[model samples]
Target: DQQVKQNSPSLSVQEGRISILNCDYTNSMFDYFLWYKKYPAEGPTFLISISSIKDKNEDGRFTVFLNKSAKHLSLHIVPSQPGDSAVYFCAAGKYSGAGSYQLTFGKGTKLSVIP
Candidate 1:
């Protein structure tokens, strides 16, 4: 069974608007969640993260919210720009003793920010 799932295959947003991407996980052991953004030909770059201990985390234009009881999480980006158009992946993980994360990722959702 897939542990992490991004139900929406794609999303579109107008410039300067808000874009919200949702994710779900089945594994209770996952204590950390990460969002990654990928361009057409480049590697996925880390965007935001949230620890299960916290309900929310924010950095600049990005914010992540975790609803542990619902086994769900979401990434919100305000004032979305064209540069933000990319594939976003949701990853769930457990922090290991070494402070590393063992993650399971979703298929990813393609985001289009229309100018």
Candidate 2:
């Protein structure tokens, strides 16, 4: 069972507030972790990623923290805006033979930004 789990299906936050989304995994072999943000009807776009070798990664308003010991990870958005409203998906993968990347994604967490 290669299921990545996002416990909360939805989250709401006021504009300029901080938003945090959580995810958990059962597989211990997963080495690469990625976060994607998606708008309605469109494919998810890569937001940020962190490897199992590191504990944290950040980009502008977004930061992702990983706790290997807990088999959990979270994405944090600072000063959330209306444009931040979208579904966030957490994915995990490891390099296999033939150089192909196979990803297992969470159900997704819908973030509603109230402006």
Candidate 3:
């Protein structure tokens, strides 16, 4: 079963507009979460993260918000630029004991920013 899901396979936004990416998880044990952005050939790069303890986290033009009760999260990019166009993955993590952590990832959503 898929623990995390990105309902929208793709999204498009105009340059200088706001882009909102959504994610949902079925696992309640997830205590930490992260977002990753991947280019065509490079590896997925860490974008932003939010812990269960906090509802929101922001970095520069990127912000992530968590709604624990709804088992949902979202990433908002202000003035979405062309460089921000990429595949975004939502990852949820939990402590599996023995100093090990486990993660579950969504398929990813392709974001396109129009010039």
Q: Which numbered prediction scores highest in lDDT against the true structure?
A: 3
Highest TM-score scorer: 3
After superposition, which runs of candidate 2 have C-alpha atoms over 4 Å from their true positions? none
**Decreasing TM-score order of the candidates:** 3, 2, 1
lDDT of 1 by residue, 1-115 (tens): 9999999999999999999999999999998999999999899999999999999999999999999999999999998999999999999988666877688999999999999
Q: TM-score for every candidate vs. truth?
A: 0.94, 0.95, 0.98
Q: For candidate 3, list the clashing residue pairs, or say none.
A: none
lDDT of 1 at 24: 94
TM-score, candidate 2, is: 0.95
TM for candidate 1 is 0.94
Instruction: List, residue by residue over 1-115, the lDDT tens digit for candidate 2.
Output: 6479999999999999999999999988889899999999999999999999999999999999999999999999998999999999999997666987788999999999999
* Lowest-sum lDDT 10-residue window in model 3: 95-104
